[model samples]
Target: MSAGAVADWLGVACLVAGGLLSLAAGIGVLRFPDVLDRMHAATKPQVLGVLLMLAGVALRLRTTSDIGMIVLVAVFQLTTAPVAAQMIGRAAYRSGRVDRSLLDVDELAEER
Candidate 1:
């Protein structure tokens, strides 16, 4: 009923949601049929899951002192995850690990 109680509940919910997203990412990586799909699984949901958990921690702590660290972590995760995924996906494609049939566009192929 109190504001503190609401904040606590919200923080817990965010953590749970993040955990579920992490689980989904793991399952997707394992079950996906291709390297590109697996890279997608490893990056997309994983980034959001980390950000959500960081947000939950921030909310639960209710302080400004650690905000910088949390923001740094989130920014680092957001910036690196997609780039890493793209590089890995490109490597998979170039190495002939990705299934050609699943791709709709092949601009890399066109370039070569």
Candidate 2:
């Protein structure tokens, strides 16, 4: 088999895996009971899924500019998802939308 064929197969695999993860993330966001749980579902798997999709695209495109753009997208996703999740979680906690019983450890509660 040629290197191109191998790359194509890997790219396809990444795309499929990413799609599945994204789907799971969507289902989680819908099914989870609370704001914190939904935020976890929305940020964690979603970011990884986006990165995987970008990797697949980069592999298929194989151009400098295309790969560069993909890297930028991945970086932005990694940087923003966690921050957004933190902010949302904090807001939910402050607004009393988070269920205290669902949390194993309540570090934020100590401040109150």
Candidate 3:
């Protein structure tokens, strides 16, 4: 087997894994009992799935500009996802949408 074939196979694998993770994340967001749990589902696996998909695209493209674009996308995703999730979680908490019973420690409650 050639190196190119191996790379293609790896790329396909990454794409498939990423797709599955993304699907799971979507399902979790829909199925989780609370806002916090839904937020967790939206951010964690979704970010990883996006990164994996980018990796697969980079591997398949194998061009400098393409890889650079992918890196930029990855950077933006890493920077934005956590911040977005935190904001959403905070908003939910502030609106009393979060289920306090599910949290082991409600540090934010002390501030209230």
Candidate 4:
């Protein structure tokens, strides 16, 4: 019933929700049919999950330094995840591992 206890509960809730979202993203990685679909899985939820977890940690930690690190983590995830995704996508495109059935457009490969 205390305010501090209520805040702690909220932080725990955020952490749990974040963990669950990351788990869902992992499931999508397994369940999706093709590279693109799976990449979609890898991209959105991965960022969301990172954001959520960072927020959760910041809330729970409740310190200036923890918050700075959380912001850094969020920035790192936002920047790096897409670059990695692009690399994987390009590799898949070059190797013809792409599932064309699912692709309406691919601008990566040099067209003859």
Top candidate when judged by TM-score against the true structure: 3
Clash pairs detected, candidate 1: none
The local distance difference test score of model 4 is: 0.84
The sequence of per-residue lDDT tens digits that candidate 3 reaches over residues 32-93 is: 98888899999999999999999999879889999999999999999999999999989999
Q: Give per-residue lDDT, candidate 3, residue 8.
A: 85
Question: Each prediction's TM-score against the native?
Answer: 0.93, 0.95, 0.96, 0.86
lDDT for each residue of candidate 2 in 22-111, tens digit (9 for 90 to 100): 999999999998898899899989888888888888878899999999988888889988999989989999999988987899998967
Query: If candidate 1 were superposed on the true structure by all CA atoms, what would the RMSD be?
Result: 1.5
lDDT of 1 at 76: 91
* Residue pairs of candidate 2 with colliding backbone atoms: none
Q: What's model 4's lDDT at 27?
A: 98
Candidate 4, residues 12-73: lDDT per residue as tens digits?
Answer: 88888888888999999999988878888998887888788778777778889888988988
Give lDDT tens digits, candidate 1, residues 9-111: 8989999999999999999999998898789899989888998898888878887878788999999999999899889988888899988877898777766
Candidate 4 C-alpha error for residue 71, in Å:
1.1
Candidate 2: worst-modelled 10 consecutive residues by lDDT: 103-112
Best by lDDT: 3
Cα lDDT over the full model 2: 0.90
User: Which stretches of candidate 1 lie above 4 Å from their native place?
Assistant: none
Between candidates 3 and 4, name the one with more favorable TM-score.
3
